[model samples]
Target: MIDFSANMASLMLPDGRSVRGPICCEDDIRRVIGQVADAYGFRGFLVLAVPDTGCNSLEANAIMTTYPVEFLKGYDSAGLINGSPVIQRLRRSTIPFTYDAHQLARRRADGKGDAAICVFEQAGMPRGIYLPVHDAGGHRAAIAFGGDRPVVSNDEMQELNLWAGILFSKLVEVRERDRRGSGSLSRREVECLRWAAAGKTTSEMARILALSEYTVNHYLNRATRKLDSVNRVQTVAKAMRAGLIN
Candidate 1:
């Protein structure tokens, strides 16, 4: 949702260098990402959406990366993001961490290893540092810089962490701005959807909100209609994506 062509006419980096010109298309975004990756001494980069609490599912369309397109397609086809050990670790830790492909392969719960890691290794990127970011509302995301070797220096890690955090914040701001442009959901609808997104049942939500079960279902059904979602789960997901509910 970033209007890169409008907002990113030029970007000034911390190093005092200017990244010039508007990002006119998807290829331009990729070029900008590649430039940023090179500036941080990385061969590839990824932006991943962190799932909401108690939700193991990741949004399929929420990923952006400078990795090989075919490899990314393969990873999606394999549905590896749901079981990604790197993302699981990031969810538990506050600080950025480095990971090797082998370590990730070994950490899979199924013990069969992840096809994404295998693809990354085959693509010559075996290790990387992951920088996690969370907003005040508990919306989580991560920016990862992948390379052929580990980033060993603590100072470098700290620097990259700061830069990545800033970049991710900007991206989040853009997404929120775009979401705000959509038709607004009412307060009760959002409240009900938030609880639904948190995995609460209609009866539980009714109890918590001090509303009748019928009223709770009404709010949810209204939200679902507004979001054009097929059901409660899809409604919650759409609401989250639109920043209408946390």
Candidate 2:
């Protein structure tokens, strides 16, 4: 578990009325969500992520929060609750997409396979607002709320998107800079690093990437040396912290 003592709640308030937020850290992600949930007396908050590649064997390092463990568990196991239409668009596009009664009402009466509509229709979700967030690499991630159903008017949505883009974009930019900063590792080296972070062995990585074990080892070794890691696991951890891996 991460430490939350640093008072880590420093998220840019998606709340329009007030501009106040506490300091945040990795651990505070949950605490902050709890605070938000209490503010509106909502059911829960869900955080989902899209990986750089592949659909299976993913790391659901995401957090899905809702009242009652049963509800959260059901929603989580159902899979793709995180990848609704609203979220898919948010990741690919440079805008924050909103899902609520107003937006959903505009869709065809037949529902025609709109992702957000489908997700909202799911059994466990609380009927409310959903926001899809994008990171610096253009990968999509999202947060869904189950509660009072906050509405984002056109003007509010525009304003939120503008600052959200800036806030998240900068966070991603810093992470990417850290990723690319390994004194400038080659793309191939970075790829190796990413696979390693996912707990792939060197031999496995070589087989997956179609590269020789020697080349793969060389890349990892060099990267390790560049990163000044004491060992392979340490190297991987450093790479992840530096955003060299997902």
Measured by TM-score, the strongest candidate is 1
What is residue 188's positional error in candidate 1, in angstroms? Answer: 35
Quality of model 1 by C-alpha lDDT: 0.67
On lDDT, the candidate that comes out on top is: 1
Instruction: After the best TM-score superposition of candidate 2, give how far the Cα of residue 31 lies from its true spot, in angstroms.
Output: 4.1
Model 2 TM? 0.41
Instruction: Summarize candidate 1's per-residue lDDT along 45-140 as a digit string, tens digits.
Output: 877777644554343423556565555556656667667777677778767888888877887876547576777777677888888876657767
Q: List the residue pairs that clash in candidate 2.
A: 8-24, 8-25, 9-23, 9-24, 10-23, 10-24
Tell me which residue pairs clash in candidate 1.
none
Candidate 2 C-alpha lDDT tens digits along 1-246 = 222122222333445333245423222334555555555545565555643333431223243343443343443454543443443454466444555533643553434334434444453343544455665455676555565445546754544334333333444544455466656565666888889888899779978986546457656776787788888889878878888777
